[model samples]
Target: WLRAGGIQGRAILLDYASWATAHSIPLSPFTSQPIPLAHLRQLIAERSITIRRGDILLLRTGLDAALKRLAPAEQRAISTRSSPDFIGLEAGRATLRWVWEQGFSAVASDAPSFERGPVLGDHADAEHTLHQWLLAGWGMPIGELFDLEGLAEYCAAEGRWSCFFSSVPLKVPGGVASPPNAVAIL
Candidate 1:
């Protein structure tokens, strides 16, 4: 049980708008691809995005826009579908090393989960999934279903990925989770 209020830090948005726009496959989010670490690094360098220690990483998978295009009935049906899948950061030792080295305070994404869903494979000594590594192992909070479209657009227009971010969760004792109520300021 992770507390949402504990997760707060400077926010940075990694926009994959182009990728999402070009691909329009329903049922699977962003075609169920895993964002390679190299590609991620390339994006940061290309965009001149600077990541600092203790910063929160906000990944924009563009799932929100994709979902909105679906009919309400379709959306409802998809929502209830078992074994849903989506594109997200890869879960592995390399990814863990990168995140640890970069010193991200926490990681959040617009997708359903921070890491790709239906995670299948033998992850030997490593944690079964990124969710386990981040939340249980690292004690880092993970935020999902974030509305990052506006932020991604704003960052793109401004040519800045970093922003002053703040979040406050409801102070409920023994609460497992709460709305982030997060805000970002340029």
Candidate 2:
């Protein structure tokens, strides 16, 4: 990211929060809810998403909006957790296989991490990490904690999921990560 500056391309938003709620698929941003592959495929089919190579997958877990609604003290409690946890895509073989086969250029989410938090547990031990699978293995970029509430609404209102996405990352030479300034054009 530092060398290349940032990533930009056709981005697709899978508003799992809205879909799950409408379908009555229980989910919470605070707990460690692993979004199963079946739900994702179902979501794609329902939304008529045509998966394509080099597409950037932008997943909305509703974490950003959820945090905003919390009281200050409750928000602090979450931020200060020693074992930070949040809802995210499932971390396992099936999901990883699907991600790879889909040939996404990059993946991002409103959650803290693409795959569930507490990456050290089954996520790391099983060797199904986005860090390893997407970044190291497939050389795909990962995004997290993006403010996407407005984007979600715009997409819904526009009745589209795909967008022209771009990001401007701080040019900190040799830095590992930078907060991404991202935008999506419907």
Best prediction by TM-score? 2
Residue lDDT tens for model 1, 1-186: 224345556888887654435344323474456766776787787878889999999888777878888999988987787656677777878888899999998888888878776565442224547888888899887888888888888887888888887777677788767787888888
Regions of model 1 farther than 4 Å from truth: 1-8, 19-31, 120-128
Candidate 1 global CA lDDT score: 0.75
Q: What is the TM-score of each candidate against the true structure?
A: 0.85, 0.94
In candidate 1, what residue range of length 10 has the lowest lDDT sum?
19-28
Question: Which whole-number lDDT from 0 to 100 does residue 19 have in model 2?
Answer: 94
| TM accuracy, model 1 | 0.85
Please, what are the lDDT tens digits per residue for candidate 2 over residues 1-186? 446657888999999999999999887888877887899999999999998998999999988998999999999999888887888888777888899899898899999988887665844446676667788887788898888889899989988999999998888768767888888887
lDDT of 1 at 146: 86
